[model samples]
Target: MEPPGNATAADKADAVETRHRAVLRKFIVRARRVEEHSLAADKERLLAWARGTVTLKFEPQSGNSTMTWDLPEEESLDSLAARCRPFLLQGDPVYHGKVTNALGFFLRLAPDELRNYLREIRESWRPLDPGDRETIGYESRTGSISQALGDLVTDKELAYAWLYGDLVHADDNGEERLHGHDIDARFQAGALLITNVAVKAISTLNLARAAQSQNYLTLEDSVFTERVVARPKREVRVEKFATAPVGTPPAEIEAALDGVVPRPDSSKD
Candidate 1:
C-alpha cells in the first residue's frame, strides 16, 4: 500500500536517485563500479571537463554539513574559472573532496589512505621539496609504487582484489595486461591537489556547480568498521551444513564392513 502524504514510494526512489546523481555530477571522480573498458571513456570525460569546454551550471542542494549540487546546461569556461580562481592552487577543502572521491572510486583505497592522501596534498604545497615530485612524475605510464605510498599499477593481484571487492571484476586469471589505476594517477589524482593546472581546471569544472557553497564530502571507513563488528559466520555455516543429512541407501550400507574391518572394541561389547 502506498503511504499517505505528498511523498510516495516512487517519489522517495526518484528523490534518492536524483540525490545520488546530483552527488555524482559535482565531482570529477570516475563512477564507482565502472567496467574496465569504460575507464577510458571516464578518463576522456575528466579531461574534457577539465579543459572547460563542457556546458554546465551550478545549482546547490539543500544542506550545509555537506553541500550537494546539480549540474545544469549553461555558461562558458571563463566564467567557471573565475569562480575557482580564489581556491586555485590552495589547500582547499573542495579540492580535497575531489581527490578523496577519485581515490575512493579508483583505488577503493584503504581507510588509511585518507591520511596518506592528505599528507601528500600538504606535502605538495612546499615548492622547494623536489623529493616526491622528482620521484613521482607526470605522464609516467609505468613504474613501481612506493610501499611508503602505494604499489605498482602492474600488480594484477592487488587490482583484481580491489576490483573484486567493488564487484566490478570476478575472474582473476587475466594473462593479458589490463589497464591499471596507477599510483601516479592515484597520487597525481589527489596529489595534484595542491591544485595544479589539471586539478584546478578539472576540479573547478567538476565542482563548479556547487563551489559557491561547499563543505567536505562524507567518506567513512566501512571496511574497518566491518572488521571490528564482524562475527564468526563461517564456523556457524559449516556446522549447519555438516548436520544436514543425506539419505542413506540401506542396500549399499557397509553394515558388516565395520565388524569385518575390525572396529574398535566397545566398552559395552
Candidate 2:
C-alpha cells in the first residue's frame, strides 16, 4: 500500500518499513507468550516423555495410563500449535500482503547475520538424514521393529502428520498412516517440532533486539518493547491422593473410576 499522495518517496519507504517492523514486533511478542506459557509450562513433562523417563503403561486387568507428572489431561501443547498455525502457514496475508512468519519477517527485514541464524534454526527442525538406518527406526502396531533403511520419515514429516492427522483435522491418509502407533510418543514428537518453531520465533525476536542495541540493525526503537518488566514467578504445586478421599462412598469411587475401571454396563458385554 502506498502512503498518502502528498508523501515523498522517502516518506513512503519509511511508512512501509514501519509497518513491517510493527508486524515483526507482534510476532516476537506472541512467540514469547508461547514459549513461556505453552512450552515452558510443559518443558519437563515433554522432556520426560521424550527421554522415556515417564511412560504410558497398560494394565491387563485395567487399562492404559500415563503418570501423574506426565499431565495426560493437559492439551496445551497441541492446542498451542493449532493456535499458532498461521506462523507456519504459507502465502501472504490476504489484505496486508506482508509475510506473517518469523523466518519470513527476518529474511525480508533483518540483517544477513540475523536472517542466517533464523534460517539455521528452522533447518534444525528437519532430520539430519531421513535414510540413516542406524539412527532412524520404525515399529508397527504389532510390536515388530525394524531399521529405517528406506523411505524413512523426517521429524518434520512425522510431526506434521500427527498435527494434521490427529489434532487439527482428520486427514484420511494421515490418520491411516498414524493408526496403531504409540499415541503419546507421536504427540510428544510432534510437540518437539512445535517447540522448535517457538524457539525460532523467540530467538529471532531476541536477536533482532540485540542487533538493534548493537547498531547492527538501524531500525527505529518503536518496533521493540521499551520496558519489559518481569513479574514474580509463581511456584508449581501438586496435590496427591493415595486412594479415594476418606469417607468417600463406594458408588462415588466407582463413578470416579468409571472409565479406568470397567462399569457394569461395559462388563455386561
Query: Evaluated with TM-score, which candidate comes out highest?
Result: 2
lDDT of 2 by residue, 1-269 (tens): 76889999999878876666666655555655555654456665544533334355667777756543243333877766754555565342311113233335435655777667656655543331222222212332323456333333444456666677678888752444544444555664566556555544555556666656756555656546443334688676755323677997677676555535534655565
Tens digit per residue, CA lDDT, model 1, 1-269: 33357887898766654443343343322211111112123555434433323234444673324322222122322222233333332344334344434334432333454435544544543321222233222232343464332333332232223323222334553222323544222322222221233343333333322322232333332311223222537454332111213684443245443333334548765
lDDT of each: 0.33, 0.53
Q: Which residue runs of candidate 2 sit more than 4 Å off their true CA positions?
A: 2-12, 41-74, 92-119, 122-152, 215-269
Q: After superposition, how far is residue 125 of candidate 2 from its true place, in Å?
A: 6.6
Q: For each candidate, give its TM-score against the true structure.
A: 0.19, 0.51
Once fitted onto the true fold, the runs of candidate 1 whose alpha carbons sit more than 4 angstroms away are 1-43, 48-75, 89-111, 123-269
lDDT of 1: 0.33
As a TM-score, model 2 comes out at: 0.51
Question: TM-score of the candidate numbered 1?
Answer: 0.19
